[model samples]
Target: MSSPAHAIYSSTLSLSLQGHAFHPQYGVQLIFNEIAESLILCGAICSQNPSCRTFDYDSSSHRCRLFEADLTNGAIIAAASQTSIVGSVILSASLYASMYNQSCSACQENRYQTCSSTTNTCQCPGNSYWNGSMCPLQLFENAACSQIDACRSDLNLSCIINSYGGFTQCLIGINLFTIFVYENTKIVQIETMSDYASLRSNDGVVSPNYNFLFDENILE
Candidate 1:
């Protein structure tokens, strides 16, 4: 009969070991119905593969966990031993590290513009305006104003007008009593008043019974 193979013992899990090996590491032990054979196979696998850092075998389910590198001590160990084999695999580094390239530049050039590394946006020229992902329109300078004017239309107030300005001005009498300048030229003024009463009263100077009385509340 052949002698049983002795398990290889090491202070830490072997980085090259995978699957079943000839023996478990120093702190590690195989708990399987066929512990001797399982340990031998795992040790052999780990020795052959450089990427295989560590491995675990479940006796119950006959499953194996191959790790690219050893994690923390308790992290790779199973919480409970069961009849089924259950295992977990760990890569050499975090999975995301492998997915993204850290050395790549931040900005990329497109057809319309060159993207900025700091702002992560396309750079548009001074005369160009950005439209969505591309620069579409060029900007131009605006014309200056030409001339302005001022005038008066009604009783006690003055009116001012603008030549090249966008708006017009006019004076308006409130309640036929006080004269106030209204900037917009849309309203029309009809008759004049001596005082606020003549302005607010129903009878104007054209009426025979016109009585001009200055009401103090009008000033208030």
Candidate 2:
């Protein structure tokens, strides 16, 4: 009866090797007794056991000790012969960077391909864009786009016909500000505005009384 968040949290579990040895008084559950030859084998042993969460491997004696849970109650000490192996999947702020780094690998079989830690998948380089199954050539900013989907949506760009040349170009729309004088009078100053609001101008109280255009929707 695990929640969706719990299922997501459980997937990040991994095995890592710590430099120091586990505490002597930690009292491991002893899943396998003195049979592990290498640290990798010890990790495999821990993975097989349902209760094993952490383990300590002794390089000198080849003593493999497995713990049922985390070793918060135990203290880590400096030991040259023993190596501690942790099977922690618990999500915490301190372990976020390590977990993120562990999630990334040389994109499946391709070493040159980009790897996304969030999706945990291989992706094309900057020159290409993902097209459902595979990545295709990415459209440049000024490239001609005849179709609506020709432009790259990730770059916040769109394809439209140019005003001056009448050619389709991948471009981004920007707000333009222009000043216009109404009735050719120095008493009033006005500028073009958009859907938000217009800036009010003060002309030193010189009212040259002219007809003003007001929209009822603007007041509302």
For TM-score, the strongest prediction is 2
Q: How does model 1 score by TM-score?
A: 0.21
Candidate 1 lDDT tens digits, 1-220: 1121211121123332232332323232233222424644655454334334455665545555444333322243333554322232322222222212121232122112333343333343222223222332221112121101111112222222233222233333323232332223422233242232222222211232332222224221
Best model per lDDT:
2
Worst 10 residues of 2 by lDDT: 193-202
Q: TM-score of the candidate numbered 2? A: 0.30
Badly placed stretches (over 4 Å) of model 1 are 1-37, 72-74, 82-220
- Model 1 lowest lDDT segment of ten: 140-149
Q: Residue 2's C-alpha lDDT in candidate 1?
A: 16
Residue by residue across 99-148, what tens digits does model 2's lDDT show?
Answer: 32123353333212346543454444343333333333345467776423
Model 2, which residues run further than 4 Å from truth?
1-19, 24-31, 80-220
